[model samples]
Target chain A: EPEVTQTPSHQVTQMGQEVILRCVPISNHLYFYWYRQILGQKVEFLVSFYNNEISEKSEIFDDQFSVERPDGSNFTLKIRSTKLEDSAMYFCASSVKGAITEAFFGQGTRLTVV
Target chain B: AQTVTQSQPEMSVQEAETVTLSCTYDTSESNYYLFWYKQPPSRQMILVIRQEAYKQQNATENRFSVNFQKAAKSFSLKISDSQLGDTAMYFCAFMKVMNYGGSQGNLIFGKGTKLSVKP
Candidate 1:
């Protein structure tokens, strides 16, 4: 079965530095999302993307966070100046439709900011 | 705001035994979707089963089934004839059926329940 694929299974970055997490959603999927889970915490929604633009974002997705679908296949999340609290597992998901359809999730990218 | 709660933090069942994982959610919307996802040590989130609120009948897939009590706000997963491969962290999630521009597709996930199937 086709699945969402994320790059760089794990990443380590210095505080105040930038990091980019990439995802390639299923080819036919029309909706994409980004969610994060702090160690020992519930997964939290970050943002949703459709039509190459942001659809909705949470408080955690502040100015420092940005998402882009630079190409037909690549979706990326960029964090400018990472904070220690930013350490968590970031997941990318996609679906053929919106909330009504089941969203498939990727293995997740573990982001560690020291 | 919506919240999903998985009361059982950890549960273990012997191979070939049946196990049920409990999940309760708080939602005001009558039309919504409930999902159960399994995440193994690989950390890959895999969809186990899904139930739509409007459906009165329970949803089942092979050995996996769900008892969705919309009135009680309870959606529990039941694994029958469980095997060692069933060991994993299961998450209960909620999604509201709305067309609020682009925000309609977000999912609210619970803390998850860790299940251990001992052979």
Candidate 2:
């Protein structure tokens, strides 16, 4: 079974620093998404990407966050300046079709900001 | 707006026993999808099962099954013959069907239920 893969299973960055979390979605998937989960909280949708552009984003996805499908398979999330509250697990997911199809998730990248 | 709610924060079941996790959602759209995902200590999200709102017949995968009540807006997951490996945090998620030129389909997930299948 093909699965989404994320890099740097764990990352620790200082406050005000920049960090880039990367993901490689399944080859055939066209829709990609980024989600965040604070410790002990529900997972929240950050943004969705399709056709190499952002399709939708949540309120939490503010100016500090940006996503890019830099290449054919690589999808990345970049934080301009990390804040302490930004510490959480970031998940990458992809699906063949939008809501009707199952979205496969990656193992997640745990970001810890100090 | 769409929301998914998992009332149970934690649950435990003896090995080989049956366990059910509750989930309820609020959505005006008649067409949607619901899913159950498992996250073990490894922190990997695994899709356990999924149910389509338009389909009255519930979905089942091996020992994992769902009891979906469209009228009540309820979708519950039932794990039969639960094994120790079944211990994990279970999340219920909701997604509204996408319409052409509408917002991208994004999932709204509930606070997960931490399930422990003890030996």
lDDT of 2 by residue, A69-108 (tens): 8868899999999999999999999988774677889999
The numbered model that scores best in lDDT is: 2
Q: Cα lDDT of all candidates, in order?
A: 0.92, 0.93
Q: Which stretches in model 1 have alpha-carbon errors above 4 Å? A: B99-103
lDDT tens digits, residues A16-102, model 1? 999999999999999999999999888889999888888888889999999999889999999999999999999999988775777
Clashing pairs in 1: none
lDDT over C-alpha atoms for residue B73 of model 2: 96
Instruction: Indicate the fraction of true inter-chain contacts that candidate 2 also forms.
Output: 0.68
Error of 1 at A41 (Å): 1.2
Per-residue lDDT, model 2, residue A94, is: 92
Worst 10 residues of 1 chain A by lDDT: A95-104
lDDT of 1 at A89: 98
lDDT of 1 at A29: 92
TM-score (chain A only) for the predictions, listed in order? 0.98, 0.98
Give TM-scores for every candidate, taking all chains together and pairing residue i with residue i: 0.97, 0.96
Q: Which residue pairs show backbone clashes in model 2? A: none
